[model samples]
Structures are given as structure tokens and as C-alpha cells.
Target: MAIYHLHAKVISRATGRSAVAAAAYRAASRLHDLRLDRDHDFSNKSGVVHSEILLPDGAPERFLDRATLWNEVEAIEKRKDAQLAREVEFSIPREMTQAQGIALARDFVREQFVERGMVADLNVHWDIGEDGQAKPHAHVMLSTRRIEVRIGEAVHGRRDGIPHPERGGRGAYDLAPDPGPDGAERGRRSTQAHDPSADGNSGDAARHPAEALDAGEALAAAGRTARLIAAARLRHEGLGLAQDQPSIGFGAKERSWNDKDLLLTWRERWASLVNERLAELGPVRA
Candidate 1:
């Protein structure tokens, strides 16, 4: 059976990542980063089945090629820690022929990203999954910023091109103030309250943050089994972080433009495209 596997990530300098290196690795080619005055080459890289550089309908002709496109990306963004690009990794259903798979990838990227005014460098790769099964996937590198055309001239633009229907535009909010170490203190109290030794046999009352202790300690405490203790610990920490990290990672600064919904929407679009292609192909032989 085909699998649904998709992951979206940003190529940022904060994480010590380079978009040129990422593009080279995915497309199995070479790209030079003018900002770092460095040449990134992966032309000898393997497992790239297909690669393409796609742009909006009116994009400059020069960007239709990968090398020129990525080099231009490196040159335009002068910030030392600029976010170079966003990448989406998704699996292709093996039921489709290689041609169908490639077409599906190109069509998906063209519609979901390029049509939305972003340059897309898409690649189809063949590799092994953790289970050692053959994994045929697509790597889509999206421009961090969108393109705007004024009087037929293509120029770099902000994300204002894509707007939330409800919100109208991006909104600003007061930064949530830090609530101090109360969470850590609460964890220690909860640990002691249920401790077996607190009743009698439990050792000294000295309690540390649950995370500060290991799983073995819960098993030795014997009040709650290791599993329950671990579960409770997770719940406590999850609550502490719930305010900041959404379940789907929305609004994460770690991502390009801090737009969390971008990945989710792209994944859904790719899945739909894969299904549409499968339906068109009807029954395919292994």
C-alpha cells in the first residue's frame, strides 16, 4: 500500500542550514552562494529521478533554470541569517509509473506554489525508508518570498500576496510574557505528593523537576509505575509548552515567514494530487 508521508521544514542559518546546499543535494547539481562566497556542489549525488525549476507565468526566463534561480536567491537575500527557502518532503505512490509520478509532482508544485507566485524547484528522488522499503519521494524547494509583477516586471515581494480570508492580513499581538519557573516548581510538588516514600518508605523530600530525573527513578519510587510517571510527566511538560507550540506547529518562528499553515496546506494539496493521478491512471502494474 502507498504511504502518506509529508514533512515541511525551513532552511535557515539559525539552524546552520544553507539553501544552496539543500538545493544542490536535492537536485543532484551544483550551486554557488554569492553571500558566503562559497560553491556548493553535489553533482555526483545519487537517487534524483527528476528535477525542475518552475516559476510563475510571467517570471523572468533566467529563473527557469535551477542554478541561476538558487544563485539569485542567495544573492538577493543579504542578511547573514536569512531564511533561504522552504522545503516540502512527500512520498509518491509507487502504483503510478515513473512518468506519471513525475508529472504529478510537477503539476502539484506548479499549481500549489508557482501559481501562487512562488518559484518552486521540485525534485523526485528514490531512496530507502527506515523500514528498508523503497521510498520514492518529491523534494519541493519553495521561495521564501513571493514574486510580484508590476508593469510586467517580476520583483521580489512579501507574503502579502497570500492572505488569510478571515484575517484580511497579518496581525500583530503582544508578546506573551514569561510566566517564570512556576511550572518546574509545580512538577516537583506533584512528584512529592504521590511519592510512596512521602507516606512512609519514600526517601528524602528533596524533589527535582520531573525532567531533571530519569525514568528509572519513577520505577523505583513505586507509587506510580514507570509508564504512568512518564505519561504524567509528559502531560505536565506538554501543558507548559501548549501555549507557545501549537499542535500542528502553527506560528513557529523556526519556519519560513513563521507561517505554520503553509506546510499543512501543501501536504494536503500534494496528497490530493497523488490521488487524482492514481485515479487517472486506473489500475497500474507493479
Candidate 2:
């Protein structure tokens, strides 16, 4: 039988939870949390069939490294009660094969979260119970902020009529990524970085100005995602532009995300995705 279960919640420091630790546990890996000066090791943990980090199209490639991604997320937030990350867990229809299950989860995440500009750390677990049945489920740790270049109002320099020495880099600035929380260790006063408006000379499309001008339909669709991110930013900052939101993945949640209706929407979406997959496999399996 197909069971629908979707759970979402914020991981807050006020509740004594750390994103690094949560990620390590879910991925069954070891990660050194730079902010806490400690290591979260779950290398021996079991039942983790797959783990992956999904970023927006224009996001930094370096963030592919799980440890680096979460550490950078931890570095960007400067609040004791800060909402570090959002987590979603849902059940996968037991009738589906492992490969089908993986694909289903990945597709849902890419469309719902990644397309919306959120970074998602996806972990799929297949646990076997004493009844000899596999209880397969997916756990997704999502970044509250959408991926984008965050520039400060204080202009520094220019390049081709663009902000060259752009402000805002307390968080994950690929030009100069912060080493620790609040960047206090490195004296993060001015985050002067490279010319984002530069051409292919930089070799990094994520930082290049041509990114917005990309001709692909996918890239063009980023405009809608951008608006969604911006709206979330305002909601995260209490109805105004927030300067502290990082260039990294840690700030500004979509206001509607907190609404109960949104959860129902997600639930419906999940069920629809699952049913579509099952139907393709036929009624017997479904």
C-alpha cells in the first residue's frame, strides 16, 4: 500500500540543534563544523542508501562538497536562535524499486526546492524491519535562502558599468568565502570581490554577469525563482530588505512556506509524483 507522509520543520539553534550534526547524521558521514570547532561523525551509521546536495543552476560548484556547504551555511548565520535549516521527510511507496524510489525523490526536490532557488541536501534511507519489509523514505535538508549574489548598497568600484567591487560577503562569497561564523576570525569588514559583470574570462558562470543574459529556457526561468527568493527574503527579514542575508545558503524563508496550506500543497505534489511513477509501472505494482 502507498502511504503519504511529509513532514517539515525548522532546525533552530534555540532548540540546541546544529545543521552540521543533522547533516552528518542523515548522510552517515563525518563533517568538521568550523563554527563549533567540533566534528560531527556518523560514518558508521546505517540505512543511508544515497546522499546528495542539489544547488541552484547558478550556485557555486564548490558547494558540491557537503561539509563545505554546511560549514559555509553555519558561518553565515549570526544568531543564537537562528533558524539554521528546514528539513522535510517523506515516505516512499514501498512498491517501487530502489532506483524508481531514488528518481522520484530527486525529481520532486529538483522541481519544488531547487527550481525555487533553494539548496537541498537529499538523503534516502531504506531500512529493513523485522517483518522483512523495507521502509524507504527520503530526508531533505533545505537552505532557507535562495541562491544569488547579494550586494550591499555601498558601492565600491565598477566594471563595464557594473558593480565591480560589490559589497556584501560576510557569508559564502566565492571571491572570498568567509572562514568562520560572522567572519570575526578573519575581520570581515569589507567583502570586496571580483567583477561579477565580467565575461567568460572568469571561467565561472555562476559569478559572471552573462548568467542573467543566458539564452537557455532554464536560465530564463530563473527570473521567477528570483522573485520567489526576493519575496522569501522580505518575509525572512520581517517585511523589508535584509542586509544580513548571506551570499551563501542561509537566510530568508518564503512566508507561505510557514503556512499550513503550503504543506498541503507539498503533500499533494508528493502524492501526485508518486502516483505518476507508480502508474507508469502499472496497476499491480501501484
Candidate 3:
């Protein structure tokens, strides 16, 4: 899967706003004034300024409809106990579908707040790319409130006969087999040679199907299945964000293929485009 990073900043000068509070005010105002169809205006109710929406366009006409964006802003403000000062950074993986990307981004903001043990209210927006492809991304404006942390104990148990003193027990004990004198075979041929019903049944008796496989053999099979599942999931997620190249085909796909090949090309093209459109942002400093 390809991975790309997206960055967005608010146009404070245009709206005569600078801080998070100002940004939130302007966003609420714009939302209230939006004339989507000359008949409908999606305005916020009194005392309810937070909003979020997803708009599919290169530069969405209305970008502050998504709630997560504002939630993030609110989160930052609360965390700092002051106005948000700069653009927030989002690490987006290219393996998500446009819609999935939007959902993931929204979820990510919530997850971030949860990880910090905070609750946030805010607005969000998603914009597409010039190619009309869903370059799903968000703009978050949030409140500035710090969230409190909650703690809990973790419990663990073992399937084997091992005990854990840390969890209020005597702890696990290991029993090692005693070696015979002069390094000779120990203890009745290990029950495999004499008893047919033993784990191996080697005394000229038919081997049980279960005994035919060793622990290593069983684990190897399971490992292969797990890898296959992981690879499939990765490929599925990556396809949503990157263009499918003809060389990467079904039934012949290889995980070793470098996603950088796709990402690098996109980066080069995007750099040129962004430089042209936002020359005032200055050259990408290193």
C-alpha cells in the first residue's frame, strides 16, 4: 500500500481570525451562511458552534462541516488551556478507501482524545484531489479543555499449569527431566518405544495421526496461514489510497514489492503541483 501525508491550515487573515476561538467562530459563521442550493443554509444553533462535514472536492466550498475537525481543535485548546496556535499533523496511510480514510481520520481524532483521556467538541471537513479521486482528509477545529486520566488494573492468566505470584499465586514452576548416568537413555525408552498408546508409539505399532506431527510442524502450518491473512489485509487496505498498477496483478502479487515506488512518483508530482499553486508557502524547506 502507498502512504502519503496531508497538511492543511486555516485562512485566518481572510476571516479576520487567528486563534482557535477565532477560527471556531469564523467556521460557525461560514457554516451558518453557506447557501448550498440557494434554498438551504446549514447553520449552527445558538450555543452550538461545533460542526463537522465531509465535502468531496479539490477545495471544498464548505470545509468545516465535519465535527472531528472542530473536536481536534477543541481538544488542543483544552490540552493547552489556550488557543490552538498551528496546524495539526495527521499521519495518513494510503491503504484506506476515500470513505474509509474519512472515517478513519474521524476515528483517529477520537482515539487521540481517548488516549489522552479527554473529551472534545469540534468541526471537521474533507477535501478531494484535482483528479476527482477521494483524497479524503479532514480539517479539525476544537475546544481547549484538558481531559482527566482513568486507570485500571490488568489481569492475566495462563492455560498451562503455571502460576503467577504477581497475580497472587506461588508462580510457575518448571520440571526438567533428570539425565541418566553416563548420558545413557533415560526412563524406559521415554514411553514411545514400549507403549503403543504413548505419544509416539514407536514399538512396531501404527503411528497415531496426531503423533505423526511434531509441535514445530504444527506451528509452521499455523504461521503460514497467519502470514497469508496479514498480507491479504495489508493489500486490501493499500489499494484504497493508491492507484492500481498493471504490474501488480492478482494471483501473482508479491509482498516484497516496494510501496515507495508508487509513493515517490506521487510525491514528485505533488511537489511540483503544490509549488505552483502555493508558491507563497515558499519552497518545501528540505
Each prediction's TM-score versus the true structure: 0.59, 0.65, 0.27
Q: What's the best-to-worst order under TM-score? A: 2, 1, 3
lDDT tens readout by residue for model 3, 31-114? 221111111123452322224432222222222333333323333221122223223324333334444444555555554432
Sort by lDDT, best first: 2, 1, 3
Q: What is the C-alpha RMSD of each candidate to the true structure, in Å?
A: 19.8, 16.6, 25.5
Clashing pairs in 2: none
Error of 1 at 142 (Å): 0.7
lDDT of 3: 0.32
How many clashes in candidate 2?
Answer: 0
Between prediction 2 and prediction 3, the one with superior lDDT is 2
Candidate 2 residues lying further than 4 Å off, grouped into runs, are: 152-256
Q: What lDDT tens digits, residue by residue, belong to model 1 across residues 1-286?
A: 5666676555555446677778888889878876567888899988898988887766677877776777777665544545567666777886766787788888888877787767788999877678986678898888755443321111133121221112112211111121222222211111111122332432332233254457787557555445554564476576663322312101111223334465467767777877777777786665
Model 3, runs deviating above 4 Å: 6-95, 118-126, 147-286
